[model samples]
Target: MTPTIPTRQPCPPGACICERERLVEIQGADLRILYLTRQEEKRLLDRLESLSSLSDLEHMQRRMFEQLGLRVTIVPSLNEVRSMRGIGINIDELPGLCRKTRQAIPAAIRRGLEKRPEIAYELLNANDLLRDA
Candidate 1:
């Protein structure tokens, strides 16, 4: 058995923030992962409704492609991560890009303090969101 950590600090979403980017290079599938503080996460959802693209994964897909293997980014704003365009040389390098892309947001949200299933609809599944595929 292990002891539970006790602190006022909010728990992390405990997952990567996989927001796929636009089909910019078309080399291979691209993916971006990011880190966020709980405070930032809360503020993001609070201001979420203000963003039209917030609910649409397709619109955010472009960003994700650029953000593969990301670090030091905020979950809410997706700030401070380098783009994969420079890091990735070809499609094969982005192994499982599609799979990672799917788990990014919903998993992050699940680890969050609250999970909004209503607005989270688009965040749920790629089949439902990316119909053009």
Candidate 2:
């Protein structure tokens, strides 16, 4: 017998390639992976582990939003995320997580990047923010 797979609800109209506006964006001419929670981090990593190419990024994004079911959108830069309020990221714990994630992502991404280095170029920093408020 085959197990059934759950489908993610379609994103609301007007959001970009993502389910909402908080999934992807750009800042300072570079892409910033924003609004990541501890939850999203695990999902994203689970998806990443199954990928063999950079092209898989889109699927990673889609898979994540599908699991999350939020009003996500994928913009081009983090600057856009910076310009918004309640952008799905809870800034209250940002500074601390920024420090920890920066330090931890290197080791965490090392093995993954061994297969696909494009991710190295795409996000200089991927901060996993939580909105646990």
TM-score of each: 0.23, 0.28
Over 4 Å off, model 1: 1-56, 69-106, 109-114, 122-133
Total backbone clashes of candidate 2, pairs 3 or more residues apart or in separate chains: 13
Give the best candidate by lDDT: 2
Minimum summed lDDT over a 10-residue window in model 2 is located at 87-96
lDDT per residue for candidate 2 within 1-133, as digits (tens), equals 9975432333446532442233223234211234455555566555555556544644654654454332223222434333223122211222112333333333333455545655534432333332221
lDDT of 1 by residue, 17-119 (tens): 2222333234653322223334444453344323333344333334434544422122321232122211111222332223342333434433331334333
The C-alpha local distance difference test score for the whole of candidate 1 amounts to: 0.33
lDDT of 2: 0.39
